[model samples]
Target: MGHQTETHVWDEELAPEPRGRTWRPEAGCPVEVALAAVSGRWTTLLLRELMGGPRGFTELRTLFPDLSAKVLSERLRTLRERGLVAVERRRGFPVRTRYELTRAGEALRVLLVELYATGEELLRLTTASETRDERSPGRLEA
Candidate 1:
């Protein structure tokens, strides 16, 4: 059996939902929720790599040469557990598995593109400001 990450019900003694079961947030921070979905250091980059297409382990390893096999495996497992990726068993002389993005993962592509663009613009602005400050010593106010 697969491990279940969520609790079905809360302890009634402490706090109870009128419906007995609920999926809505209870005054929790939104950023906390978002971060929970994409918390690992390599998760964002992994997602970006997957956005291109389904890739084999070797392909991913080549794409991110700095990541160790152990770290890559863990990240892949995490993504699979979160339902962002699906693994298919290949049928042939040598059985193997392939990973592909789920529909949920595909949905993140546009948002990721926008985020990348925004980061580029911010970098450009910051670099320009730093250059100007260096060029004119007293022009920038700290």
Candidate 2:
């Protein structure tokens, strides 16, 4: 043997395995699924309002003064599709429709409360920092 050279071919079996905890959101993950369901804009607000009781289209619109009717309608539709909201159409001369939170939606009450508390704490910290900066002798206000 005059000269010998070794060559290696990488294969699936020879590939390095992933280390540490894998963090992928599978379809069966409840937390991931819940987040996906509530990730839409105005979703959390709508859920909070619905948690109180059933609300009609006009009533919901009134709660969100700046939101347009079209957007509200879309949000409601999305919630209904996610099984978080149930819409009941009352047959009357005026034909009123009411939207209420389903059991699944109601379960998010605790999470929402925690979120509100977290927001309050964050706001408090931000205000405190701003006040401290303003009072600093060498700091310039922008």
For model 2, residues 21-65, the per-residue Cα lDDT tens digits are 125766655656667777888989999899999999989999999
Q: On residues 20-39, what C-alpha lDDT tens digit does candidate 1 reach at each position?
A: 34456533444344445566
**In candidate 2, how many Å is residue 84 off?**
0.5
For residue 121, model 2's alpha carbon misses the true position, in angstroms, by 1.2
Clashing residue pairs for model 1: none
TM-score of each: 0.68, 0.71
Q: Candidate 2 — number of clashing residue pairs?
A: 0
Clashing residue pairs found in predicted model 2:
none
Off by over 4 Å in 2: 1-22, 25-27, 133-142
Residue 45 in candidate 1, Cα distance off native in Å: 2.4
